[model samples]
Target: MKTIKNLFTALLLVLFLSAIIIACKKATDDPQPTPTPVTSITSIDPSTAPVGSTIAITGTNFNTNPASNTITIGGVTATIVSATATRLVVVVPTGAANGPVSVTAGGQTAQSAASFTVAIPSVKPVKEVRGTTFANQNWKKDTVYLIRGMVYIPADYTLTIDPGTVIKGAGPELDPTGQNISGTLVIERRGKIIAKGTAAQPIVFTSAKAVGQRAAGDWGGLVLIGKAAINRPASTSFAGGVRGVVETYSEFDDNSGTLQYVRIEFGGTSQPNAPTNKLNGLTLYGVGYNTTIDHVQVSYSSNDAFGWFGGTVNAKNLVAYRGFDDDWSSDWGYVGKVQFGVALRDPAVGNPAGSNGIESQNFDPGENADGPLAKQNGLPQTAPIFANISNFAFSSTPTVGLYQAGIFLSRNTAISLYNSLFYGYPEGLHLDGTATGTLANITSGALDLKGIVLANTLTPVVGTGVITNDLATAYFAGAGRTNLIVQTSDLASLLFNGANFTLTAPNFLPQAGSPLLTGAATGGKVADSFFTSVSYRGAFGTDNWISSWTNFNPQSTDYDR
Candidate 1:
């Protein structure tokens, strides 16, 4: 009986050992649960540090690998000096503003409970700038540059301006020779200006007067001259050069550098010793195709907002607001391509010489005694392609009589316009100077206008000197043309927010169901690769390109601060 009990106990022990082994195997094969990592920001050392200062950030569950951790303060990326699982050391970025500090790691981001303050440094002393630049120079954003007189960037020199820089032009003053000392920036031939600013930080060139004291003609404007071809007489007022003199061998693709996201306000003063010679807000004199100019705004100018003398440069997203004279003027063999342009006029102000949205000409004197051949067929003629332009004259006010045509093409120029809108003008389109063969350009397909909409104009088409108004009207209403004519009463249905014409704020975007939203012409000059293809007829379909960087009420903004 003792032997039988001992055998049963041994069998029971073996069974128990087998059960334990099977349980151990099951446990080894099964997966384990991973704990979720917790990330939090405790604090940042030197919470108020200026740009480029080093700061230590304390956090939990940060990536041990420095490269794996991404740190941003005030929405600007910072350079990480070192990183640990629980802390990080970083240097503040140059453009960093006041905002919360955040650390992103291990696919998770942690934000601080409080915002980090960026210390404001003392006001940088204003630096006086005058004369010509002999060497490459950099204008820092922190310092305010005061242009006291005409400043020139000579050949082989470059002027680099940091983003968000403020350049103030002194008010017109008298020089020793009893001449007006205007503050103007002239970029001579072969010179460069790298004044590239961002959408968030646009460079501003404004008047030096106090906020309420600013007005048009407060200072001179910006001028750029390159070694591009120009078709002008030797006695040209702005820059003297004979036609075809440089057209065969000039640098059509010269690199005069960039000017992006820039604003020039309260400019356009008369040049010294020449009362008839007024400076435009921005003038391009023989600039070339390699020059970059885009996202530029010229406001409250006494003369034309933008004037292209001769160049092959292309531009986009240009704004001209409340200019006393023409918004855009092209002459002297300007063959550039421009897209997405906006022009808003103020009814309260007008130039006695006549104000128009666009004034294009091949030369000043169309019927020069020099004969018709030199005036009519100037080599490298003033033919520029402009697309998606929105011109608003606001002529419904009492000052409607002061405004002229929306577009005036004369002096035998072959400027082509496509997919554009012109509203509230006395005359929508004017073809002037029959002696100079201006009307012939339209018949010959040299100056083309397609996919155009004219609204609230007393005269939709006008022809002067020999081209009859009926002839001009027939061309606009020709077959295969998508031109539209809308009356003042029907403007509300054609535009989504057309009522807002206040100088403080204006809405240029087309509304849903508006004709400008679709049916843009794609053939002809618009088909060129220089223009961006869109189904919109105007400068804007739904997007507002003028937002954020543009300031419509510059007179109220205090630049001294």
Candidate 2:
């Protein structure tokens, strides 16, 4: 009996040991790391969703618990409905125009991944109604719509245009008025226009003509009229131009409309050197405030790329290339500020191919006309005033050299600048006036300048008997880089930042171990925004902003124009 009891106890012990071993094995092989819960957006719904359409987003690793969760595209917020460990759904919001869409979740951001395109319905035409007027009826593209010559905007109508829409100008020999063939877009009073474009599909206001063969001054630039602050002194012709008083009014300057991501090509000519002839890429007369103008480019105009007379308008991201006369010529009296501008000279266009970057001032010298009858009354004079001009680049060669000042500040012209760069010309900086211009005073007035760079190699600025390296560097930093090499990882910002260098893949800033990085004036000045770390020497910053895009190479053999 005693032996039997011992056998039973040993059996029980064995069973208990087997159960413990099984439990230990299960815990060791368990899969409980959780993987950190990663979430990434893969694609968007209705990828071609039109404007006002609700966009649905699909992605992985969505937060099942709806706390501390958010999603955005291009800095614009999106609405999320449902989320899970493997999927997320959201809707695109209004006022979110076309551009890149970046997704952020749990503090993680991914850019340059997917694009959000705004849908634009095809334009259809309506027969002439009571008060509606249409321009360019001759070049109609569809049956319901009028062709290239005429387009009608309803009274008080607001037109929304997507970027990348190439609106061709009227071809030659179509209109009898001669003004018609200038490929014009006229905005009437009391009308609103919104022509916006993005970087990828910028709205191009070009001619239907093929590329490469396109000539300068091919079409009439955009013409907008509004009621705002304008200095209309006496002697400033009203009939030839627009009539307005030199006064500041707080109201929306119709602009007639807004233009963005627009490129006006082959514009600016009054029929071959008539001088007084009227043609330009964009003509703003009596344009008012309350209009948005950004990323507007005017290339190869016969006259001026942008001409403003007797209006208060503000523009940004203006590019003037290879115009015959001036890149930005303001007459009568314009009161506004401009930023982020590039005036590039063309080696093949004008008699010299290069025109001055600016021809700014009131047309009436010494006459401060603020009214249609300013000559009779007398207020502030007729000269236009520029308040702020920051981040601008100018370049000129002997063949395309500007005849006068690179920045011609004519009669009573006032301007302020900050974080800007100017280079590549016969002279680094030029100020032409009867009275000695106030460098200190001008620098203090709304200029807010910090990082400024002035570099040149041609003639007096360099070579023997000219300014030495120390003096030139003191006066104009980075002058004559013909001997130096510029290392750049990105070309988009470099080109867009508004600096001049013949090579597309330019070495503007110091490299990882370059000597120029030690307190060197980047972009001709010492500003923080010009670079990420140890600022680049020119317009673009050497930070990660450039690491994404490919470098541009413009060689003598590779250059077309």
Which candidate number would show the highest TM-score if scored against the true structure? 1
Runs in model 1 deviating more than 4 A are 1-122, 174-178, 239-249, 366-378, 395-400
Give candidate 2's error at residue 211 in angstroms: 3.7
Query: Per-prediction TM-score, please?
Result: 0.76, 0.53
Clashing pairs in 1: none
TM-score for candidate 1, residues paired by index = 0.76
- Best of the candidates, lDDT: 1
Question: What lDDT does model 1 reach?
Answer: 0.83
Predicted candidate 1 versus true structure: per-residue lDDT over 1-561, tens digit per residue: 999999999999999999999999999989999989888899999889987779999989998888998999999999999988888999998899898999999889999988999887676678888877699999988888998777888889999999999999886572222345777788878889999998999999999888789999888888888777777654445621101222332578888899999999999987655567788999888788999999999999988999998778889999999999999899888989999999988876888656898889886773452322363223547899999998888746324456888898887788999999888888888887664467778888888889989888888898886778998889888888888888777877775565447678888776678877998988777889988899998899888999899999999765554
Over 1-561, each residue of candidate 2 has an lDDT whose tens digit, in order, gives: 999999999999999999999999999889877666556667777666654346666666556654445766556776766667555565666556666666566666554366777676565442221123543222222312111332335346555555544465555444444434434555545556677666665565555455445676555555665655455533333221222223443343445667776767766544322336665778776676567776777776778878876565677656666667767777655655565565555534443444555566544544433322232222232333331122123333332244433444444444433334444444434443322122222333411223344333143222111223344334333343221311222223234322234334333433454322333323432232322333333323343222212122211111111
- Which lDDT value does model 2 have at 90? 59
Question: How much RMSD separates candidate 1 from the native structure?
Answer: 9.7
Q: Give the Cα lDDT of each candidate.
A: 0.83, 0.48
